[model samples]
Target: MKGIKIGEYLVNSCTMYIEPVEYANKIYSHIVEVEEEFLSPFKPLQNIKNSCDYFGVDYESRRKGT
Candidate 1:
């Protein structure tokens, strides 16, 4: 899957999953913001991990892309 790599974390691209669409959207946006240096990475990474774990999805897939 396509994703953005921030340091060691991998935030996957927005995909149609069984989970709520908002979760995926948030993950994408949070990572993008981090990449763009608009926000610090800690909170967003925490939220992304929580969302992925809650939905039983793999958010940590390594790929470099927009």
Candidate 2:
């Protein structure tokens, strides 16, 4: 976690964002190792998903105009 810093962390919640001061790959590896303890206890092993709708994918339809 040397080059990694926790950003926009919510207390008592599993949701947290981390920023890397150095290479991104290294940061990802570190997270994978401790994901169980770092993430939700109910489902410790979960696939990471993008929170944004980049490239207009709209996977969750969050930007739908209705």
Candidate 3:
């Protein structure tokens, strides 16, 4: 699959599977906000084990597009 390599992370340009929720509307709302603000809308590849595996840096503290 074609994707962008941001540091060591391979972010696939595809939509990921999100499980449907029944209750916990408040929690769902927070999740939506976090996805919009922090998580990028890219599917994580299965091959990638850790962020350092691709980016050549420590996995503890690393930013995307760095």
Candidate 4:
């Protein structure tokens, strides 16, 4: 779980968002990158579509106003 610090949070290379919720209140939303290692573990059994299945969010459909 190694990542680079972006502003007050850390963003990995896998395009996942991780940050403190309290500080995030200042902004509408927080978007952070994820690391390959984090994603590599799930690569075998998981299929990553738009947004994260873990969050139950349809990132693509949401962006299209669906």
Summed backbone clashes in each candidate are 0, 0, 2, 8
RMSD list, candidates in order = 13.2, 10.9, 11.5, 11.8
Query: Which ten-residue region of model 2 has the weakest summed lDDT?
Result: 39-48
In candidate 3, list every pair of residues with a backbone clash. 8-54, 8-55
Candidate 2: residue 26 lDDT (0-100): 32
**Tens digit of lDDT per residue, candidate 4, span 1-66?**
333323222222454543222232332123444323222222221233412454576657645774
What lDDT, from 0 to 1, does candidate 3 have?
0.30
Poorly placed runs, candidate 3 (over 4 Å):
1-9, 12-49, 63-66
1-66: candidate 2 lDDT, tens digit per residue: 342332222222353443222243333312323333232221111122233322334444644532
Q: In terms of lDDT, which candidate is strongest?
A: 1
Q: After superposition, how far is residue 47 of candidate 2 from its true place, in Å?
A: 12
TM-score for all models, in order of appearance: 0.29, 0.19, 0.21, 0.21
Residue 30, candidate 1: C-alpha displacement in angstroms: 9.3
Give each model's whole-structure lDDT: 0.40, 0.30, 0.30, 0.34
- The residue ranges of model 4 lying beyond 4 angstroms of the native Cα positions read 1-51, 62-66
- Model 3 TM-score relative to the real fold: 0.21
Model 1, TM vs. native: 0.29
Q: Tell me the lDDT of model 2 at 23.
A: 41
- Clashing pairs in model 1? none
